[model samples]
Target: MAAETSFANASRRPRPLTLVAIVLLHLAAIYGLARAFAPDAVASVEDSVLSTITVTVETKQFEPPPPPEPEPEPDAGEQGNEGRKAVPREVVAPEPRIVVKPAPPAPKASSTGAADTSGARDQGTGTGAGGTGTGTGSGNGGSGQGGGVATKPEWIGGRINNARDYPIPPGGRQARVGTEVVVKVTVGTDGRASDCSVFRPSPDAEADAITCRLVVQRLRFRPATDAAGNPVAAPFYWRQRWF
Candidate 1:
């Protein structure tokens, strides 16, 4: 009974070879199951394990580039000065000049035989009482009836009384052969007839009136000058006779 009990305990303890063989048989069965399911089941288990694992990546910060430098300013004596503004200059005007002229000298006076001291001239055709100048003078004791130099006015176109220009009275009013008309006309400084009047009337009044009208219309004179040679208004005498 003691030996049987010892044998029964040994049997219950399990043999080493049988345990090894059973472990090998279980491994073979697992290998066979893996082959049956193929590589699909193995890949799914690897993907599950890899998906559960977490990976961390670090990011680096980048800095910006530096700013560009500014350009230098040009000097005053540089060629760029041609574009600069120019300073203004002051201007001056010249002074005006003045001039003066001298007056003319007085005319010389004529002397006679007795050497009269008076400054007047003698213009009479006949003998005078007393005069300093020549032309039919006989007086030496007193001042003569002489005055300043005088000149008669002359017609601008020609001598008056030309029959064609100054015709006789119309309608033959004057039957007399010796019909005459005389007029006195005043000439202005501008050599124009300013006024006229009949000095001597003809037999016919129409003849006398026509003489003065024609004188003013057709006559213009070189105005008479005084002793000083300046133009002066003077009287002019004209006569017209009809045959």
Candidate 2:
């Protein structure tokens, strides 16, 4: 009986639990993993643009076929109809193809500059922007800093822009001339330079002539603007001078 008890205990002693423990340990095993990122990493945005596409066209020209020769009329006893008051046929002229060139650009027109509204030394009237400037007038001021100053190409003239900027000749100066005269001419909305007098004049007659020329022919103003800032055609004055 004691031997039987020992055998029973040995059978129930958990059978040294080796293969089951190994399978459980294998199932519990886990693998390790690692990851890294750059310091300047940023999210990106995507955009799409539609491009203009054009289709290419090809063309072929064809020439007209020659006119058929007139059938000879039946002979009437060997008599030709050359003298029988032959009917006059209408003649068609051939169409000729010629290439045309583009026309040259028209001359641009410029007006006297906008009246300086700022209270600076502008057109030199003591009354401010509306006031005239000191000094007599001439064709243009002395040449500026560079050997030649830049001038804009004139093309804005409609009927005509009289205010043209004339370059003063390089050899035309000896010394500065006399007291400047300032004239305040009220110009109408039209581009014409009217009521012209010496707004500013040099002491010399030549200088004053510059003012007259500007008033009569060269001085132009953009059409006067209305209260709403829209451009309207009207008469305006030439406040010209040279010094």
- Find the candidate with the highest lDDT and give its number: 1
Question: Against the correct fold, how does model 1 do in TM-score?
Answer: 0.34
**What TM-score, computed on C-alpha atoms, does each candidate reach?**
0.34, 0.23
Per residue, candidate 1 scores C-alpha lDDT tens digits across 112-212 of 32222333433433322233323333333546644433665666664344443333345432463466666778878888886788776767776567667
lDDT measured at residue 167 in model 2 versus the true structure, 0 to 100? 29
Worst 10 residues of 2 by lDDT: 42-51
Poorest stretch of ten by lDDT in candidate 1: 55-64
lDDT accuracy of residue 96 in candidate 1: 31
Q: Residue 154: error of model 2 in Å?
A: 14
lDDT for model 2, please: 0.37
